[model samples]
Target chain A: MTLSITDVTKRYKIRVTRAQVNALNGVTIDLPAKKTLGIVGESGCGKSTLARMIVGLEQPSSGTVTWNGEPIFDKARNMLSSKHSNIQLVFQDPYSSLNPRQKIGDSIAEVLTVHHLVEKDAVQARIAELLTEVGISPELAHRYPHQLSGGQRQRVSIARALASQPDLLVLDEPVSALDVSVRAEVMNLLIDLRERLGLTYIFISHDLSMIRHISDQIAVMYLGKIVESGPWDSVLENPQHPYTKALIAAMPDHTEVGNNAYEAPLKGEVPDPASMPTGCAFHLRCPIAVPSCSTNAQTLREIEPNHQIACQEVK
Target chain B: MSKPLIEISNLTVSTTDDNRTLVNDVSFSIAPGEAVGVVGESGSGKTLTALSLLGLLPRGVHATSGSITYGGKDLLTADRETLRSIRGNEIAMIYQDPMTALNPVMKLGAQLIEVIQSHGGDTSNAMERVLTAFSEVGIPDPKRAYESYPHEFSGGMRQRVMIAMALILSPQLLIADEPTTALDVTIQQQILALVMQERRKRNMSMLWITHDLGVVANLVDRVIVMYAGRIVEVGSVKEVFTNPQHPYTAGLLASLPKASDKNRTRLLSIPGIPPKPWTVGESCAFSPRCSKADQQCRSSLPVLATNTHTDAACFHLMGDNS
Candidate 1:
């Protein structure tokens, strides 16, 4: 039930130029069963790339993705077929993920039937049961995806992912596409499902509030490298890395806005991932970066028992 | 208080086919230099209300009855030429997605110049003005930004360009319709701060329409909650956010995951989704999902009755209005 990612790197070769794009560089993390690990970063930080690799949607260029200490993507063994069903991904866009022409019940039942998770005759009953569990009416099972609201569509997507009874659900901005009110609804549903079903979650988002709300553990990624990792509260409230501090400060809250004189900390936009700097990718934007920060890339070193930071400035 | 800048009374917008009302009898007024936020989920007519201020309702949709009085003139009755001149000159709008708002093929400089020239006076210093606008919006290397197209700029940069374009002319009123929703959270904060800074410097009236209550709390002075084509509640940001009167408003405020909500297991969410404009009858549009709904709430719609420092359209308020 434990999923471990060890020094995984993903490189995508450009079709025409043949230059390698290092989407992820030596990323490592341990996601234990029944605990939530939140991966947070801005766009082009390789959080989604790592998510894709974890769910077996994309193979890693180097390193291993092990489920219970066994590699899941070994080509010769074809471990994906055996391990893929245990991990599922819920995408950001519910509108495009589900087939427009298919009915909700048929879509959910299709996953069960493909994996043979349920008996043939009991498929219809199971579909209804799953629909109701996700807070959707059983009657809406016959309706098409378009007939459902955004919240309902997301629920249907979640039901499909839960059909195989995945132990780890990789939610990539699952509620980001939803409206504010419905986001709370879907988030609560996920919370309920995880407790009832005893599931582990890899929650990815650029929203700081959401990350702080759900993550038991958090890993802050920058340019494919995790700059900081620790228990959620420790990393968020007492952040070690300067980038994490800037990110937390930049969050728009009630008190932050009234002080109009407050200065914005970060400088410039994120650097192009393809042409990243030799040392720390965030050194260019890091306010407190030192001389050595530009030449040597820091590796994750444990400062506390479970807290690790990859910044050389943090002792 | 100073005279209200723009007053909207009984504004009803309807689709051409079957005259289905998308915005129903909405009334509110913005004070001069005040920031007002309109909040709701999709299909709440918040966008339509913002669009109606400039008489920019799409084809097949028109304001059936109501008056948008701004600067001693009715916007609904204003001529096309008047609207055309007022738009982007005295009243600018920033859309949700900067990608679609900008042209893909045209150079950023050219697009900006074209906008400045259309509200015509002189084209001699157009390049300088464009660069100035870019610098004002904190875009580094204005020369390179001018030469590049929209696609070359990132989402945050594109939005900055859009903001620069909107404010280049120094509009008296700015209607930003969910301008930061498409951006990352940090980027969204930057844009919100930028908008607030520019508004104060120019003393411009801003109507920020969004669904994020937390964002509204930070950015605006007053908040108006809209539901299925009607105004559910309106109050100061402090009053409404701290003590929301309408059930829908209360539900929306409770639903957000705040910094205070850390380690909490469940969020209080409204049970059902909003109803479609066509599906609703004479009853309160929110009664289907409202927990405190009674027989009267299901049969008759409530008018906006005055509450403590706020106005809400709910039959279950402490005072009996009907």
Candidate 2:
């Protein structure tokens, strides 16, 4: 595994006088070394924050983040050693990811300069190589972010991320803002890059169809916890958790309708995050909820050969 | 056969900025109890066409030359009073972001009640009327929600409130302008399903302006693909999705990852952004981007031609080139 997160948790103190709520509670997962791991959840699911922790942008409230089986939170050690240099992140909005004032070549060269990988004379040549690596012309390196299109801007962002030569890239909805018209092109670019560079990815998104197309493994998050985790096709086709089922069924694709309320056409609303349900966080709207779910919180357990679900009613 | 609900003839809307034309001689119509979707990239004038109906242009654009005839009455020629009645009471609209569209200070009940009363509906127990519409849109705890403000609701709930307001008057025509653009995928489904269900139950005409073809495929019956503020293609949903004639429509649909898709390569992108008004032509505007554009296409403006239920605005569409 290239990335292993063990018992990661984040808790935010409530303002306006209320008890603190746990956003992520004891989450653990392993992302294999060259395989893309997809994290699926709605907004406020703490997936992005977890991503921030993986990339060393945000410190986790409590727990350990292991990159290449090495501890990341050890402050003095991380600063002294270059062991944590193998992980990087790519943001959702390509337009904002770049520096508008600086040329695209300088934006990429700045990273290489900071890392002390290349000399000043070799920086321009490296910029040309990086630009071509992401499938953009070397001439585009002199252009501004605004001058480039969305797809081109995204390619520049990928080039910048690749300039560090990271083993894993934390992708936070990289294609969410792009037009559905260009979604496949961008996704295919990522696949091709992974093959050529041998980079692992932690792809986070709210779009199920996009997740299914790219991910090797899938994790379904409700509130903050991942209620279900398993291989992609099986988990999406036969979701064991009710929350996963609702999210999948909510998608208006070419889906065959099931008779149960599982395909009940996405009624009601996702509950408030401030004051969550007492037991199972999803029981308030779970179509398959039983009497036990309202009182006893369910733990994620393997229900099938590889599928794990966190629902009391699944049994 | 169904009668047309609205017919826009040679619609030419020009912006006030230096007499620049936004929509040039665009023509299409919506039939009663039919939903027509308009698809395009951002700034492609899709929103401009929908805003033309309500005269909701932001103080700088105007319909220079067009006849927006609705039920034998030219909306372009209607007086302020006549358009006011049609704008809200008869022709209701729901905007993209309900949280922003709704007044944050006002209670949802008071806001919905105001729409109902403004439309000349019975005003007694106005809050009850608001709650009933909320219930109709499947809002849970409608009574509690009736007393809540816009901020108190979630993103999806805020949209439901907007839908309730849009349908409170039960208008003859509903124009939902990107209602689910701000929502999550699941919430978007809930919102679309609610709006579609309400429209079907009322048997009202709908003009859904959005960019999601998957959405239009599920909700709308027909589609109108627009570019540079002109109607490029108008046809049945199945006809367009299955056999897209225009290169733009085909590219848009092909780029989207279908629900049943396995893995594939070579997703066809149109190479560049949609043409700006300055770059648009007197002839075929899409000719520049179309791989199949010929000498005839570059010299003449393509017209919307229909063979059976399939219609498109391309000269080479007759040659089975899609």
TM, every model: 0.95, 0.93
Each model's DockQ? Answer: 0.54, 0.40
Clash pairs of candidate 2?
none
Q: What's candidate 2's i-RMS value?
A: 4.6
| Candidate 1 per-residue C-alpha lDDT over B119-182 given as tens digits, one digit per residue, 9 for 90 to 100 | 8847899999999999999998899999999999989999999999999888889999999887
Chain B TM (all candidates): 0.95, 0.95
**Each model's lDDT:** 0.86, 0.80
Those runs of model 2 whose alpha carbons end farther than 4 Å from true positions after fitting are: A75-84, A254-264, B117-122, B263-266, B318-322
User: What are the per-residue Cα lDDT tens digits for candidate 1 across A165-232?
Assistant: 77889999999888877888898888889899999999999887788878899999988889999999
- Fraction of native A-B contacts kept, per candidate: 0.50, 0.39
lDDT of 2 by residue, B1-322 (tens): 6778888888777878787888778788888888788877676788888888877766888889988988678988888878887877888888898876799999888888887777677898777778889999888889888889999888888888888888888788899888887787778877776777788789998998887776677677788888777778888777777777877787777676666665533455666566676467767788887789888888888788886547878877733543
lDDT of 1: 0.86
Best by TM-score: 1
Worst 10 residues of 2 chain B by lDDT: B259-268
